[model samples]
Target chain A: MMSAKQADRLATAGLYAVAGVILALLAGLLGYVFVKGFPMLSWQFITSPPQIFKGGGGVGPQLFNSFYLLVLTLVFSLPVALGAGIYLAEYAKDNWLTRSIRISVEVLSSLPSIVVGLFGFLFFVIYMGWGFSIISGALALSVFNLPLLVRVVEQSIQSVPRTQREAGWALGFSKWETITNIVLPAALPGLITGIILAAGRVFGEAAALIYTAGMSTPALDFTDWNPLSPVSPLNPFRPAETMAVHIWKINGEGIMPDASAISDGAAALLILSILLFNLSARFVGRFVFKKMSAS
Target chain B: MQTVAVPSRVLSSQTHVTALTGPELTRPKLETDRLSVFYGDHQAVSDVCLTFKKNTVTALIGPSGCGKSTFLRALNRMNDSIEGCRMAGEIRYDGIELQSRQVNVLEVRKQIGMVFQRPVPFAKSIYKNVAYGPIRHGVKKKKELDRIVEDSLRKAALWDEVKDFLHQSALRLSGGQQQRLCIARALAMQPDVLLLDEPASALDPVSTAKIEELIGQLKKEITIIIVTHNMQQARRISDETAYFYMGRMVEHGPTEQIFSNPRSEQTRQYISGQIG
Candidate 1:
C-alpha cells in the first residue's frame, strides 16, 4: 500500500540508521578506551623500565621490542611474499599445482594465530632450539604475515592496466623487464599500503609472540650495540616481550599496585600506534602514486 | 631493392590491377604468406597474404572483429603474449623469415615497432619514455640518449609541444600527446617499419588531423602499416588499402582504385555505408 517514493525514503532512512549505529558502536568503544587510558600516558611512563612489585612502571623495552620484531618479521617475509605474489599474478599457469598453491595460501591465512603460535613454539623453539628468542618470535609472525602480504602484492600487480604491459612489449621489453621496470613501479603504492597493514598486524600481535618469543625479557644493555653480545638489545637470540604481551601479562598477574593503569596506558599506546601506521600508509601511498603517476 | 613476383591475386583483373610492377612488388618491406591467426579454437584472421613496400603507408580497413588488429599483432609476434593465441604460415621482412620460432622476437620487435589504439605511456617522465628503448638496448651515454629522444620526438611531431617539459611525467600529457609520445617511444628504436593499430581513432578531430599529417611525413622513412575504422582516414593517409570482413581480406589495391572503382560488392557496400 506504500507509494514508491515513500518506500524509497523509508529504505534510505533504514540504511542510514544501520550505518549510523555501526559508526556509533566503533566511536563509543574507542572513546571509552581513550578516556580510561590517556591519563596514564606521559614521557616518564613511556621511557622507564617496568617494576615487578611496585607502581609507576614504563614500557620502553617492550615498545622497542615491538618495533624491532615488526622490522625483523618484514625482513624475513617480504622477499618471499613478493616472489610468490608475482608468480601468482604474472606467470602462474591455471593448473592443479597453482590452484593448490593458491588454496594453501588461503588456508594458511585463515589459520588461528594461536595455532600458528603453537606451531612456532613446537618447531622454532623446541625443534630448531632457538630458545624462545626474538628470532623465533619474528619467524612466527612472518608465518602469520606472509599470506596477507602475498595476496596484497598479487592484487596490486594484477590491478595495473593491461595496456601498460602491451606498451612494454611493443617497445621490445621482455616479460621480466616489463614487470620490474613498469609494473612494479606502478604497483608501488598498493605494495606500500599492504606492507603497512601487515606491519600493523605484526605490531599488535600477542598470542604468537607469547609462545615463541617467551613471556619474559632478559635485562637489556642499551649502550651495548654489539648484536653478538647476549645482553645487547640488538641481539636476536635474547628473549623479548612486546607491548601487547606486556599489556596482557599485566592484566592477568596484577602483582604491582598500578598493574591496571600500566595495562591501560599500554593498550592506548598500541591503538595509537596502529592509527599512526594506517595514517602513514595513506600518506606514503598517495605520495608514491603521485610521484610515479604525475609530474 | 629486389623484386619478388606479385601474388596471383594482385595480378588478377578482379582487383582492377593497372600496374603490374607497383612499388609494393619491386621494393617490398614486409610480406606475409598465407598468414592465419587463432585464439584457442576461434580463428581471428584467415589466409591473409599481403605485401608492404618500403617508405609507404598501407591501411587495413575492416569492421569491428574483422581481425585487422590480430593481423597487425602477428607481424611483430605481439600475439605470442596472448593466452592460447597461435599463428600459421610465414611472415618475412627483407627476405628473412620472421615467423620462424627460431627468430629472435626481441630483435624482430626492435626492427619493427608497434603503436596501439589506446595511448599507453609508461609511469615515467616524457624524456624517459622516449629514451627507454635506446637505454635498454645498451645506449648508455646520456648525450646519445638526449639526442635520440629529441630526434624521435621531432620525428613523431611531438617535440615542439613537449620540448620545455621533457622531465614531466608522460601520463600528465593530453591523450593525443600521449599517443604521439608512444610514437616517439617506438621511433627511438629507429625501426625500419611502424605498425599502428588505429592510432588516432580515440582522438579529437584536431588531434586526428595532427596524427594523419605526422603519418604522411613518417612514411617517407619507415614503411607504415595502419589499421583504421575511419574510411576517410584510410583514403587520406594510405598509399594502398586492404579491405577485410569476417576474418578475411576481401579486396586490396591502390587507395584510389579501391575507393573509387567497383571491384567487389562487399567492398563497395562497406565503403558506401551499406554494410559494416
Candidate 2:
C-alpha cells in the first residue's frame, strides 16, 4: 500500500543501516582492546625477554620473531606468486588446463589454516627434518599465502586496460618487454594491496606456525650480527615462537602471574601494528603508482 | 581552418570490380596478397590484396563488423596475440615476406609501428612515452634519445603543448593530446608504414580535425593506413579509399572517384546514405 518513493527510501535506509552496524562493531572491538591492553604495553614489556620464573618479563624475542618470520615468508613466496599470476593472466591460453588451474587456486585459498598447519607438520617439519624451526614455519606460511597473492596479481594484471598492451605491441616492443615494462608496473597498486593483505593475515596466524615453528623462543640475542648463529633472530634453522603463537601458548599454560596483562599487551600491539600497516600500505601504494605512472 | 576542398571525380556505377594492382607493379613499399584472417571457425577478414605507395594515406571505410580494424591490425601482425586468431597469406614489406618464420616480428613492428582507436599513452611521463621505443631499439645515449623524443613530438604536433611538462605523466594530458603522444611514441620507432585503427573515432570534432591535419602532414613521410567508420573522415583525409563490407574488400580506388563516382551500386548506395 506504500508509495514507490517510500519503498525506494526504505531500501536506501536498509543498506546504510547494515553499513553502520558493521562499522560500529569494528570500532567497539578495537576500542575495548585498546582500553584493556594499552596500559600493559610498555617499552620494557616489548624489549625484554619473557620472565619465565617471575612472570613479569617481556615479549622481545616473540615480537622480533614475528617480523623475521613475515620477511622470510614474503621473500620465498612473492616471486613465485607474482610469476604464476603473470603466467595465468597474460600467457596461459583459455583452455581446460588453464580453467583447472584457476579452480585449484580458489580451492587452495579457501582451505582452513589448521589443515595447512597439519600438512606443514607432516611434510616441512617432520618429513623434511626441519624440526619445528623458523625455516619450516616460513615455508608453511608461504603455502598459506601463495594462492591469495597469485589471485591478486593475476586479477590485477588482467585488469590492466587491454589498450596499453596493444600500444606496446604496436610500438614494436617485444612481449617480454611489454610485460616487464607495462603490465607489471601497471599492476603495482594491486600488488601492494595483495602484499599488505597477505602480511596482515600472516601476522594474525598462529595455528600454522604452532605446528611448524613450535612453542618457545630460546633466548634470542638481538645484538648477534651473525645470521647463522643459533641465538640470532636471523637464524632460520633455530626454533622460533612468533607473537601469535606466544599469545596462544601463554594463555593455554595459565602459569605466569601476569599472564592476562602480557596477553592483553600482545593483542594490543598486534591490532595497532596491523592498523599501522594498513595505513602505510595506502601511502606506499599511492607513492608507487604516482612515481611509476608519473601522474 | 585550412580546409582543402576535395574536387570529386566520378566513375561508372556498373558494380564491376577488379584488382587495383596494375600490371606494372613497381614493388610498392608494402603489399598484401590474398590476406585472410580467421578466428577459430569464423572468418573475420578475407582475401584483402592491396598495394600501398610510399608516403600516401589510404583509408579503409566500412560499416560495423566489416573487419576494418581486424585488417588494419593484420598489417602490423598485432592480431598475432589473439588466441585462436589465424592468418593465411603473405604480407610483403620492402620485398621481404613479412609472414615468413625468418622475419623477426619485433624488427617488423619497429619498422611498421601502429596507433590504436583510444589514446594509450604509456602510464609513464610524456618524455618517457616517446623515448620508450628508441630505448627498446638500443639508442642509449641521452643526447640521441632527447633529440629523437623532441623530433617525434614535434612531428606529431604535440611538442608545443607538452614541451614544458615533458616529465609529467602523459595520462594528465587531454584525450587529443594523449593520442598525439601515442603518435609521437610510434614515430620514435621511425616506422615505414603507420597503421591507425580509427584513431579519431573516440575524439571530439576539434581533436578529429587536428588528427586529420596531422595525417595530411604525415603522409608526406610515412605510408599511412587508417580505418574509420566516419565516411567524411575517410574522404577528407585519404588520397585513396578502400571500402569493406561483410569481411570482404568491396572496392578500392582514388578517394574522390570512390566518393563521387563509385563503380559498384553498393558503394554508391553506401556513399549516398541509402545503405550502411
Candidate 3:
C-alpha cells in the first residue's frame, strides 16, 4: 500500500493529467479548424454573394441575415425576458402558480432546438402561413431564447442588494421607478453579459432558423432601402438564410469546385465572431463592475 | 425658545417630568399611537407608543432583534415593501395620519427620509446620488440641482472632502464617506423628519463620531429618530432615549433619566449590560 503522501501526490497528478487532456482536446479542435479554414477567408470571399454551382463567391448576404436575425430575435426576446424576470424576482409570490411558471421556463429552456424548430415550422410556417420568412425565424429564435434571458435577468435582479431597494423606497420612489432606475442599473453588468452570450448563441443557431427562415436565400438588392420591397434584405417576410445555415447547406449539398473552401472560410469566420463576442462581453462586464464597485 | 429658558442644572428636578410626558405646544412633531408591527405570525413590535419632538434627536436603543429597527421603518412605512409584513396602529406625521387610506406612501416617504445601517449610495456619481431625490420630484434645472447637491453634501459633512470629485462614482469613496454620502442623499429631499437605522453601527470610531456630530447639529432643523445598539452613542447624541426589550418599549424618558435614574428593572438591567 502506498503512503498517504504518495496517494495525495497521485491524486494531484491525476487531476493535472485530466486537465491537460481537456485543454489539449479543445485547443486541438480549434487549431485544426482555423489552420484549414483561415486560408480560404479572403476579402473577396466575404464581400460577394454566394455562387451556386460555379466557384468563388462571398457570404455578404448570409452574414447580413445572421446579424439582422440576431437583432430581431433580441428585440423580441429582451423585453419579455426582462419583464418576466422582474416579476419572478421582485414581485412573484411563493405560490404554486409561480412555481409552475418557473418550472415551465426551465422545461422550455432544456427542450431541444430542433424540437422548437419543428414547432415553429408547424405553427408559424404552415398554420400561420408566414411561409419561411425572417419574422418566423426570429419568432422561433425568440422562443428558444426567452427562457435563458429570463433566467439571467431574474438572477441579476435578485442579486441586487436588498438595502438598495429599501433606500429607493425610503427616498419616495414608486415600486416601478425603483425597479427601472435603481435595480436595472445595478443589474447592468449581468444583463449586458447575458445579452451578449445570448447573441453569440443566436448567431450560431441553425436547426431552428433552417425551418423558419428557410434554407434558400432569395435574390436581394442591398441598395433597396425601402423596407416593403421583396428584394430588400431588411424585409422580414423574405427568406433569409444565415451564415450557420449557409455552412450547413454548403456542407451537405454543395457540388461546386470550391465547396470545401467556402465551408472552410465560413467556419473560420463563425468561430472568430464568437470569440469576439465573448471578449467584448467580458470587457463590458468588467467595465460595469468597476463602475459599480470602484468607490 | 421655550426650552432655552430652563437652566441645565435644574433639569433633574420635577420641572422636567411634565416636560417629557405632558402636552407640548407643537404636538410633538410626529406621534405614534399604539403602533405595532408583525411579520407573518411573529410579532416583532407590540403597541410601541412614542412621540418625537421637532428640533430634537431621539435615539431608540436596544439589544439585537428588539424591534427598534422595525419601529423606525414603520415611521416612514419602509416595512410596506416587505411581503407578509403587517403593521397596525396609527402613525401620524405633522397631525396627518400616515397609515391612512388617503395618504400616499411615496409622498410620506419624501417628507420623511431614511438612512440605513449599511451605507446604500446609488451606484452613480456623487452629484447624482445627492441630486436624485430633488430631480425626481421635478427639480430639472441644472443650476438648481447643483445647489441642492452642494447644500445637502455640505450638511452631511462630506462636501469639503468630495468637492472636487462631485461627478465621480460614489463607489470609490471610503466606507465612512459612503455612509455620509447616503446621509447627503437623504438630506437632498429637505425632509422634515429623518429616520436613521443604526446609521453608525457599520462605521469605525472616527466616522461614528463625525456622524454623531452631524446628528447633533441636524436636530436643530428636523425631528430625528435613530436606532442604535450603542448605549454611549445614544447618550452622546440624543436628547431623549427609549429602551426596548423584546417587542415592547420597556422605558422611555429624557436621556439623562434613562441612563442615570432607573424606571424599570429590565431597562436598568439592559443599561447595566445585565441582560441583552
Best candidate, lDDT: 1
> Model 1, range A1-295, lDDT digits (tens) per residue?
9999999999999999999999999999888779888999999887788989999888888888998999899999999999999999999999999999999999999989999999999999999999889999999999999999999999999999999998898888999999998999988988998999899989999999899998888888889999999999899999999999999898998699999989988898888878987897799788776676554
When 1 and 3 are scored with TM-score, the better candidate is: 1
Q: How many clashing pairs per prediction, in order?
A: 0, 2, 3
Interface RMSD of each: 1.9, 1.6, 2.9
In the order shown, what is each candidate's alpha-carbon RMSD? 5.6, 7.4, 6.3
TM-score of each: 0.94, 0.93, 0.93
User: lDDT scores for all predictions?
Assistant: 0.90, 0.87, 0.88
Q: Assess each model's interface with DockQ, reporting 2 decimals per model.
A: 0.50, 0.55, 0.45
lDDT of 2 by residue, A180-278 (tens): 998888878888988999999998899999999888777777889688998788889888998899889889984779988898898898888787878
All candidates in order of lDDT, best leading: 1, 3, 2
* Shift of residue B268 alpha carbon in model 1, Å: 1.2
Over 4 Å off in model 2, which ranges? B1-25
Q: Pick by DockQ: which candidate is best?
A: 2
